[model samples]
Target: MNRKVIVTCALTGAGDTTGKSGHVPVTPDQIAADAIAAARAGASVVHIHVRDVETGQGSRDTALYREVVRQVAASDVDPVINLTAGMGGDLVIDPANPTVALEGTDLVSGLERLVHIEELRPEICTIDCGSLNFGEGSSLYVSTPDMLREGAARIRELGVKPEMEIFDTGNLWFANEMVAEGLIAAPPLYQLCMGIPYGAPVDAGLLQAMVNMLPEGAQWTSFAIGRNQMPWVAQSILLGGHVRVGLEDNLYLSKGVLATNAQLTERAITIVESMGASVATPDEAREILKLDKVA
Candidate 1:
């Protein structure tokens, strides 16, 4: 009962789930609305990823990001805004010529991926730690060591805390190196992404090992996709970490039930409270994470 958990609800991700669930937000207005609703539902933070309004695909458009941030900041309810700076790393290789990048490829420099983050300067932004074979396809997510070093330094300069995204043990190892090198500030933030194909498998032993490897005083959280989502919430809390939920990593409230951002947030709160841990408010989360109030 002495624990206070920060609940972050990722409103919409840059995934291909818009077709699978009608509740997935597409436009800036929808994303903003979802963010506000999630805040009202007891979420201390809202993780955002804009999408192309017409195509409903994930986008890196600065304008779309500006609009979404504007609406959320202007709203009555306050939640720590965390933007995704992990875009522009997709590399779909051509089957005919392995050296050739495919049409769907959006590979760019790590700095290029931070265009919006550089402009908007939210309280927090994510930095994917390493490259990985993204899912079952020719697609690969790239973030080399050089790219990570540059990106981490730039984010520190911007006064935006970088949420180091750890997809595997190797990623965690490199992230620890960055912390040791003084690129990341005190109390480094980490997001242990589990159940993502070709990354870290959904294993509790692996999660515990990664937790043991974290830098001392590091603030961390873990999440799994699909049905494993809620269970991971309990697991993360049990292991002395925060929690993240929403359409980004999960879509169902129960079997055959699609969930909205707010619904997922409420569910996460229920889990937290039932576990004898209270959900932190926006201001409380800011203090816990050492983030300045941007909005």
Candidate 2:
């Protein structure tokens, strides 16, 4: 078993999860608080997504992002910040008129999506490597090759690491191509995203195939949504990659148990230690991922 696994807590996501669980943090203060608590609970990093405080809907407001980053920066616990630059690519098309943009449509220039990342300059940010049919709805999350190039190049210029979010083998293929093309910087980080409908399914064999497709010397993490979240943690660690967990992915600590970010992180640490491995501290994680530690 690999010792020194890095645990990343995804504080909140751009999902309609807030109404389902009271434990999901909404306001910036709550998000930051939960992030700090996760770090204290043994997470080496925290992935972040801002939501409209009043409506509890995922948002792209840079002010909200600024505040969340600011609070996390000021906290005594210094988990590496990883902001979601994968917003604004959402497109909810209108059935009435296929030509018309729907109410939930959020397509924008890739640079627009990075406005917050450009300002915050977090140690790491995400770029969804490919587009996919989001779900049952007519919605699609768009990340074409041209957009990927722009996002990857911009992230390179900003001196921030891009978490290549691989939703499928094709996404992985293009991500590898980006690496080969020198669009993305060296020591690339890939996140094997699974269990999302219309994306890669959560199967051991499929996950293994995706893992096998990773580039040489690439730092990677993996997670599955819902009940599979915790199980996938062990799968990822055993496969020689880091793990992610939090309210963003799974809501239950157990049957009828709602989970907070800290609890999820604590559980992941327990799993790691139980396997005769240890959880990596932020500094160790930084070294492992080849990140430049912030002072």
Candidate 3:
């Protein structure tokens, strides 16, 4: 067993899950508090996504992101901050016309999407590798190749580490292409997002296939949503990778049991420890991720 494992807590995602679980943080203050709690519970890194306080809907407002980042940085529990650059890519196309976009569509330029990351300059920011059918129906999470390259360039210019988010085999291949194109720096960081609808399935074979395609000396982590969340924590560690967990991906410790972000993180820690692996602290994660030293 690998002696050291890093646990990352995705504090809040952009999904429409606020009403489904009381643990999902909707406001800036709640998001900051939840992140701190997860850090205290054993998470080395915290993935963040802010929301509209008034409607509890996912938002791409820089002000909300600023507040969340400020609060998390000021808190006693200091975990490496990894902000999502995956917003503003939702494209709801009209099924009938196929040429027109639906009312709820929110598409923005690649530069516009990275505005928050450029302003805040977090330790790490996610760069979604490729486009995919988000789920059943007319929606698509659009991340084109040109957009990915632009995002990666901007993140590199800002000295922010880009955490390449791979949702399928094609996405993983494109990520390696980015590495080949010199868009990503050395020792690239990757996050394999599994079991998210039309993407990859949450099975050992699929996970191994994704891992096998990683470039030599790449630093990577893996996670699955819903019921596969906890299981993937152990699977990741056993496969010589890091793990991610939180209310963002799942809201229950078990069936009929709601869980707080801290609870989810603690559970992941327990699983890692049970496998004879010690959790990596935030400072250690910073070193491992090669983050720019906070001044």
Q: Is candidate 1 or candidate 2 better by TM-score?
A: 1
Q: Could you tell me which 10 consecutive residues in candidate 2 have the lowest summed lDDT? A: 286-295
- In candidate 3, stretches whose alpha carbon ends up further than 4 angstroms from where it belongs are none
Best by lDDT: 1
Better of 1 and 2 by lDDT: 1
Count clashes in each candidate, considering only residues at least 3 apart in sequence or on different chains: 0, 0, 0
92-175: candidate 2 lDDT, tens digit per residue = 887787788788889998889999988888888999999999989789999999999998999889888899999999999999
38: Cα error in model 1, Å: 0.3
- TM-score of predicted model 3? 0.98
Compared with the true structure, all predictions reach lDDT values of: 0.93, 0.91, 0.91
lDDT of 3 at 39: 90
Instruction: Looking at model 3, report the run of 10 residues with the lowest lDDT sum.
Output: 286-295
Predicted structure 2: lDDT: 0.91
Q: What is the full ranking by lDDT, best candidate first?
A: 1, 2, 3
User: What is the overall TM-score of model 2 with all chains considered together?
Assistant: 0.98
lDDT of 3 at 199: 95
